[model samples]
Target: MGWIKNAKAATLGEDARKAWDAGSPVFTPILNMPSSNAGLSGRVEDWEHMMAAVLAIGWRLHTWAVCSDSRGRPQAQPLFVRP
Candidate 1:
């Protein structure tokens, strides 16, 4: 029982780390060159990196039902729970 609990906690931590690292490719270029990252001087490679990250996370988002106001703050609405 103790080993099973520790394994479950470790798995959760690993999954969280993967999600965080997955966003870095999208953010790194923008962080290094915020002024140049927008339309005036956007790089195709950086956009591709961002798109890849977006695609990976897009599916995860479908698990939740999100409604946003004009300010874009997500209004939390319950989706479903698995037994």
Candidate 2:
């Protein structure tokens, strides 16, 4: 089971890299929450779902954002890391 999780994480990293290179969305299913849910309960439910998905995968997430600097140079800023 541990090995299986490792393999899945490896595949996920490869797929994420490909999507990043192609400028495509990598986490489509998990990210596509309905915008109509604008209540506290709805938000909590959504958070629970996302947390479950992340924990089940057994992989930490490092978030990155693409932005431009003062000189208009494109750069990636890493934020909100979990280990």
Candidate 3:
């Protein structure tokens, strides 16, 4: 199950606008993959939805790499930038 496939553009746009207004680089929710599949699909889906919205509004993906969470757990944290 994925939300992106049925996500409303207007809703996504609103989220994007909020992030843009915040004036900080947007980061996707931490993604813990093969090590743990729990919520992986949903996280990926949300990431795709957010990416689509951001790109549509002139934001670009500036970084896509692994990062450690607060607990030092490995995960993917994609950073988006505007410009």
Worst 10 residues of 3 by lDDT: 27-36
Alpha-carbon lDDT of model 3: 0.60
Better of 1 and 2 by TM-score: 2
Per-residue CA lDDT of candidate 3, range 1-83, in tens? 44534464456566768878788666343444433344344454444555576678777778789766666655676666778
lDDT of 2 by residue, 1-83 (tens): 44544554455455444545565433322232223433223243433344344434433445645465555544334332233
Best by lDDT: 3
Candidate 1 worst ten-residue window by lDDT: 25-34
Which pairs of residues collide in candidate 1? Answer: none
The C-alpha TM-scores of every prediction are 0.29, 0.32, 0.46
Q: Give the clash total for candidate 3.
A: 0
lDDT for model 2, please.
Answer: 0.41
Runs in model 2 lying further than 4 Å from the true structure: 29-83
Cα lDDT of all candidates, in order? 0.35, 0.41, 0.60
Instruction: Answer with 1 or 2, whichever has the higher lDDT.
Output: 2
Candidate 2 RMSD to the real structure: 12.1
Itemize residue pairs with steric clashes in candidate 3: none
